[model samples]
Target: MNTTTLTGLELRPLAVPADVSELETPAGHDFATMMDVRNRVYFEISGHHDESMSAAELLPHYQPNPDEIRFMWVAILDGEFVGRAGIDIPLEEGSKTAFWQIELLRKSWGKGVGSAAYELLENKAREHGRTVLQSWASHPAADGVEQIEPPTGFGSIPDDHAAHFYKRHGYSLEQVERNSAFDLRGSFEIVERLLAEATAAAEGYRVVQWEPPTAEEYVAGYAWMKSRMSTDAPSADLEFDEEVWDAERIARHDALWTDAHQFVLVTAAQHIATGELCAFNELVVGKDRAEASHQEDTLVLKEHRGHKLGMLVKCAGLVKWRELVPHSPRVLTYNAEENRPMLDINEAIGFTPIAYGGAWKKVLE
Candidate 1:
């Protein structure tokens, strides 16, 4: 696809380095400058205290992966970076959707830069055979809704801000999600109590914690449980497909995190008699920012319901994360509004609403 041109502005692919050390090269310099622009806009719009990705933190994303292809582009005017955009295409069979996103500096928002960049992104997605494009935008709760104050260091945008933007671009809101966070330093007693109850309820299941490069014995079972996330998680009315995962794919995912120096803390509940993995949860902490961690996935197999295994694994994982990354103060997670079970668990454990976001989709003819 050819690059798009808009009055003194040009949209071109931005080259990211494979190795963190090579960021000083000419191509890498452009990449770094582009990220700086993105970070500035993100922080300004979200009002979040989270720091932008460092060179080391950003290198792994550029690494080649067989399962997905990513394209990054920069919008430049008069030799200055004005905005950036990206499109991610999944190579898995039956997956015909591309995730697209574009961000422009606050000062450049009213201009034609965003439109030009998005046009280029759409062309690229179509060239790759994607028939549907999806994107997510965050905003505060709408009027007449109970307003929940976000936790310290977090922020939310006005509800109409992103809604109007996407609507103008032909995307429809499919689902709304509540962004929640747990201040790890607030209170450990509730988590301790939940842990005790879950432990008693899950009598025959034992919890196992491990770092990345998951154990060989649990690799197959782990992959199986991970694959279920796509089908098990609530997607509301959005059109989505289940993902296929195997032992090989799991290993490849582990390598991506390892190369980026990120830490993955996993806790799984194993059925004592059957020796089968039934439930699991994961906590991820970027090496550059140990002050905050992300709650990735927490799923309990169908047969394991009512055992409180979800709470068990989550509590165990959080405790393990504290031991591994003691400096981390908060953990962030997002859950669909209709997912009451998980929401109940999170609320009981002290997670509060931080923001709201909508998943938007556009089907191309």
Candidate 2:
């Protein structure tokens, strides 16, 4: 069925085809255009195409997932696709929080198109019984732009266009996340030195590494660590449901990366005696080996802190990642500004801050 598009300023749910190959069919037309606008919009904001992805690379995420229900829409202003919005509703029991995003070309701002699309998203969230809504947007540091700091008192982000919009819509800045990048082409002397220190500090743990489809003996431990990401990470006021993961969820997660033709490396810390996986770090690169690599999730369980596992896993991941994808120029990662421990590790590994993103939230009646 054709997606419902209203007049010139239409904001309608994107109708995706069963597969990316269906892009040739009318069914995939909206999906293709949305991906295009998404890419251009990001590049315009960051001046880097690191976040760009082909529709095929993003389709699996838009597909139905048992854990998160996705609602995506495209905005057409005067018969041209100019923007897109999405909401991901986590299926935890009694969930009242939904994470959403609204992206549009800079030229489309102040046209009321974003407001229209937001109404579409807010209405859907209310329909799903959601009470709290959260979203994030990169706020590039500008020389004269005012800045807003979260109550957590860690990092501050420019109160630029996105911040103004969020304030106008009743959302409060709860946290700021730092977007950091490590120069892979630079020397790894610091990384190797820190790895040795972390290794010595983590006396009872050893580094274990793998790709997708986690090994049989490590599935349970890996799944448990993955679940803790929802709670173990620092979030001052942003709401997140405690996710439960198992072998099936791991398989599904692995399949998403594999199907997208992306290479992923998982470096984890295992307890020497109990064989428990205490920490993990992930590095991912798209089909093009030369493109920027992404540092996905790096977590050290709360009970396992103070052992420098965070640094151990991170340095280990980067050390191996260079050998895995020798040509990838750089690695990018994000962490809450309040997460000083992780930020400290990244800084010691030669990561430099490139941008800051604001985490905003609003509550509905």
Candidate 3:
């Protein structure tokens, strides 16, 4: 299907190929162009390439998946690609949430391009039975720019172009997230000390580490922890469906990383007495070991809090990650500003705020 606006912008559905080898096809070529535009948007916002993914590494995810449906469209002006947008609808039973994103080159702003694209997105969401739409966008800092703070009172984002656009579209700034980075080449003395203290404090828990394609013994426990992420994490005024996870779900999650040739190190804290995985942390780096690593999904179960398991798993993971991907320059992570405990841990580990983002939401009438 094709959509056009008064601004002479055309929105065409993007086709996903079965594999990267299909790039020789017209659809594959369009997909590649979309990826290029995506990376450019990320770089322009974050001033770094860490968020960039190669076509080969990102293609597998665009293929069919059972858990959700993804639709993408490219923005064309005067027959040249300018940007793209997409919406992901989770297939969980009775879910009303649809996550979406819209991006256009700087030259395309204020031309009614974004408004026209959002019209199509909102219409699609309604067609899919989604009532709540949420999105997060980086609101990079700028001198003299006003800031919008979430009711949580933890972080604030500059009222930049994205903020104005979202507000005009009937979305409210619901939460703010902090983007942080840790220098890997810096000293690890503090990491070593924290690991020791946490290990000593976590009396009945032991640190366990492994790579993706989770081991057989830990799959169930891992699945339980994964499920808890939706509930356990600090989400201010935002809604997430309660996810059900199992061995099959774990496999699907692992393949998205392993199949992309990305290296993932899982550091988990296991209750030695019951052999239950109480807490975990994940460190990931793409095919290029020299680039920045990503810290993904660190959680210490609510029932197991106060044992310092959070610090134990995180520090242990970092120490191991350094040995495994020593060439990686640094590690990057994001957390809600209201999540004080996690932020404390990050700050103590020498991570500092590099940017802030706003989490916005709008409900359909």
Candidate ranking under lDDT, highest first, comes to: 3, 2, 1
Residue ranges of candidate 3 with Cα displaced over 4 Å = none
Which lDDT tens digits does candidate 1 get at residues 1-365?
43546677877787878687778888688777887887787676668756466666777777777888999888887678887888998887878889988887877776777778778878888898888899876675567643322222122334375566777888876666778899877768889899999999999999988888988998988999988898888775565657788989999878778888888888999999998999999888787555578898889988888999989999888777777788888998988777789999999888998877777788988
- Worst lDDT run of 10 residues, candidate 3, spans 1-10
TM-score-wise, the better of 1 and 2 is: 2
What TM-score, computed on C-alpha atoms, does each candidate reach?
0.91, 0.97, 0.98
Positional deviation of 355 in candidate 3, in angstroms?
0.4
Candidate lDDT scores, in order, read 0.80, 0.91, 0.91
Span of ten consecutive residues with least summed lDDT in model 2: 1-10
* Candidate 1: clashing pairs of residues: none
Which ten residues in a row are the worst by lDDT in model 1? 147-156
lDDT of 3 by residue, 126-169 (tens): 99999999999999999999888898988898889999999999
lDDT of 3: 0.91
Better of 2 and 3 by lDDT: 3
